[model samples]
Target: MNSSALVKHISECFIKPQYEVEEANKPVYLAPMDLVMLSVHYIQKGLLFTKPPSNSDDQISFSTPEFLESLKESLSHTLVYFYPLAGQLATQVDEARQESLVFVDCNKGPGARLVHATIDMTVSDILTPRHVPAVVQSFFDHDRAVNHDGHHMSLLTIQVTELLDGVFIGCSMNHALGDGTSYWNFWNVWSEIHMAKNRTDLVIPSSHLPIHNRWFPDGHDAPILLPFTRHDQFVSRYEAPPLAERIFHFSPESMSRLKSKANKDHQKIYTDSKRMISSFQALSALCWRSIIRAIRLPDDQVTNCRLAANNRHRLDPPLPENYFGNCINAITTTTTVSELHEHSLGWAASMLHQSVANHTNKALQDFLKRWLKSPFVYQIHQLFDSNSVMMGSSPRFDMYGNEFGLGKPVAVRSGYAHKFTGKVTSYQGYEGGGSVDLEICLPPHAMEALESDEEFMGAVSLPLTGY
Candidate 1:
C-alpha cells in the first residue's frame, strides 16, 4: 500500500467503545510522591503477539470476541486491587496556604478507557528490527492515550488493536500514578488474573498485590511544597531540534565483549582493586561515547550522561518488593568531550559505574529533601541539550513475559514517540535472554553518523531479512 493509503487504512480501521469501563470499586486519595509526577505525559507500553494456533486449548483465543471480553473482565478485577488506576486526577487550591494540591478522585465516575481497534496488517509488518515501524505507531490512539490541559485526566487508557495474524495491546498510564516497577506490577497482576479466569481453584498470591502506601521521610505534606514549573516551561529552556528514533539490538555475546573490553581498558589506566563494570554500565558508556563521536562535538565541550536509577532498594529502610509509586532518581556524570572521545570504552564505563555507586540511601533521602524544597529541579529536560544524553528504563523489567494467555509477546515497546534528541530507552530482547534492545532518538545527522560508526556497528547485530 502507498503511504496515504496506509494512513487511510489505519485511520478507518477500529471500533470505538459505546461507553467507558471503570473500576468496580470506590475512590481513593493521591499520595505525596504521586503529586510530583502530575505534569509529565503518560507512560505508554505495547505488547505485540502473533495469533495462537487453532489447535491450542488456551482459554483466551487471539483476536476473538471472547478474548476481548475476558481481557476487560480481568482488567476490572485487577483494578479492584489497584484502585488508583481507575481514578482521575483532581486539583484543589488552598487559598489560605497559597498553594494547589492534586489528588486522585475515585468517585469521578467513568473508569479507565479500553479502546478496541482493528488494523488491516500483520505482525511482521511492524516488528521489523532496527527501525521504528509506522504500523507500531498506529497501535495506540495517541489523541486519547495522552493527557491534555482542560481534560479530566483518566489515570489509565488501554488500546487493544487486532491485526490480521496477531494482536497489539497498548496501555497508557499517568506517570504520576506509578513508576516502571509499579507499572509492570499492575500488568503482571492483570495477566495473572486473566490466566486464572475460569479456574476457581487458582488464586493470585498476596505477593502480586501492589503495596499502595507511599513511603516518605518524616515531616512531609501530602503535596510536598516544592518550587515547581510546567513541563513545557522546563523543557523550553533546553529544547533542541527534533530527533529521529531508531532501535539497536545488541546480542548477549556482543554485550559480554563490550563489558570485557571496557574492563580491560579500565585496567590499562590504573588497577586499583578491580572496579566491577556491569553490562548496563558498559553499554551505556559505549553509547554515550559513540553519540559524542557521532555528533562531532568540540574537543573542549562538556558532556553529561544521566541515568535513571531506581531507589527502591537505596532508601534508608528499603521499600517493599511491590511498593507502588515513583521511587526513582536520576544519577548524572559529567565529563569533557575530549575524555569521552579520547579515552577507551573502559574509561567511560568507570565514570558511569562511579556515578551509579554514589546513590546511597542517604543520597536518595537528601535528593528527596532537596526536591521538597525545589520541586522543579528535575534534569529530564537537560536531555534535549546538545551536550547531554539521558538513558531511561531498564532491560530487566520482564516486558516479554507479560502473557495474557495469548502466548508471549513477539515484541514490546514504549508506544509513545520520544521527542528529545538524546533520549535512549533500553529493553531486554524479546526472547527473554540476556540480549538488549536500545530505542535511541537523535538528530537526523547524528543518527546517520551513528549508523555508520565502526565501533558502534561492531557490537550491533545486523537485522535479519524476516525480522
Candidate 2:
C-alpha cells in the first residue's frame, strides 16, 4: 500500500522525568545481560488505534494539540519511575585502568523524546495489507542504526502520528535499556497512568512498581570495565543482508490443534504424562520445521534454533516480575535438516523443551561467572548465522492491553531494525483467546517457499492478519 504523499513532520522535543533523580545524577551501571546487547539495534514497535467514537462522557474528545500534550505529560510521569530510560548512555574511559565502562548518566537532565507527525492516511490503510506498509516506519522518530548509537541520542523515542481518522503511537527503545519484558512493563505502566483521572495523585501498585537495582556476581564491582579505550574500538554495527518479513496469525482452534498434535505424537516415545508439550514449544517447533523444509537444506546440513529464556525466575533469589532490566539468555537447540524435517513436530518440540529445562539456576550462575572473566561484546557475525534461526519476544507481553486512553490497539507492528534471516517474534493474537501471531523475517526465496508450503498454511486461520 502506498502512503499519502503529504507526510509532514510537526515538532520534536524532549520530555524529562517528572521528578529529579537523586545523588546529583549518579551513574547506574548495566549488568552483563544489558552490556551484551550493546551491538544490537534498538527495538522499534508501535500500536495502531482508530478514532474514538464521540461519547457523551468525552473521554477521548480532545483535539490534536490536547492529545499530544496529554501524552507528553503522562510520559514525563512514566519516566520518573522508569528513570533509567530518561538518561543517556555514557562511556567512562579510564586510562589508568586501561579500560572503559558504559553506564547510564542521569545527570545533566536528558529526557525521552516526543515527536509529533502528521500523515494523510486512515488506520485501515496501515492494518489491511498482508505485508505491513513501509510507511509505518515513518511513524517512528529515529532512522536509528544500533543501540551503541544510544551514546549520542535519545534512549527512548515516542512519535505520535496523526492519521486521517485515527492515530498511531510508535515507540523506539534502546535494546540495552531492557528486553521485551522490561519494554512492555513500561508501556503497561504508562497506559495505567494515562487512564487515571488524577494522574499525579495515582499510586502505582507494588505489583507494577519497577526495581532499578542492576544485578551482578557476588564478588564483582559496581561497573564492570571492558579492556577497550574507545566505544568504536569494540562496538560497531554492520550492514545486514536484505530480508522479507511477514506476520502469520493462527487462531485458538488452530493453536490447540498444533499443541494437541505435538503432545499426542510425543506420547509415542515417552510416557512422561506430566511433561506435555507447551503452546510455545509446539508453535516454535512448527515454525522451525516449516522453515527448514522451505529452505530445502541438505539432509546432513545442521540447523540451529535459539530460544530466549527469561532469567528472572531462574535466579536463586527470584527477581520481581517488575524488575526492570535485561535478564534473558538464548538457549540454542541444534539438529540436522533431515532430523528436523522428517520427524514429527513433537520430537522437535521435545528437543526445545529439554533445552529450556536444562537452563536452570546453576547454568545462569556459571554464565555470569564466565561473562565477568571475559567481557566479550557481540557483533553481527556472532549473532546470526546462515543455518540458524533465533527467536525473541514472547506472546505473554501485555501489548494489546496498552490502551493509553484510546481504545485497545487495532494491530501491533515492528520497524526494520534487528531484521535478519530466520528471526521470529511472537505476540498474542489481536482477538485474544489462545490465538498467536508470529512475525517472521526470512530470505526472499525462503519466504516464497514458506507461503506456498501446504502443511504450514493449512493451520492458519481465515482472513489471516487484518481485521
The TM-score values for the models, in the order shown, are: 0.87, 0.95
For residues 1-467, what per-residue lDDT tens digits would candidate 1 score against the true structure?
Answer: 22221322222221222233354233334444555555445678788888886765656444467887777777877776777777676556555665555556654537777777776777766665346764566666443232322137466777888877888898887776788888888888888878884633447777778887667677874545433233343322223355667888888788889989988888887687467889889999989998888888899999989887888888767887688888876689999999788888998999999888888988877766776766652333533476778788888786877788878787776665344767788887764457888888888899999999999988997442212
TM-score of 2: 0.95
For candidate 1, which ten residues in a row score worst on lDDT? 8-17
C-alpha RMSD by candidate, in order? 4.3, 2.1
Writing each residue's lDDT as its tens digit, candidate 2 over 133-230 gives: 76777788656468878787888999888888788898999888788888999999999988889987899998888888888867886888887887
Each prediction's Cα lDDT score? 0.70, 0.83
Backbone clashes in model 1: 1
Q: Give the distance in Å from residue 399's predicted Cα in candidate 2 to where it truly belongs.
A: 0.6
Worst 10 residues of 2 by lDDT: 458-467
lDDT of 2: 0.83
Off by over 4 Å in 2: 1-7, 55-62, 272-274, 463-467
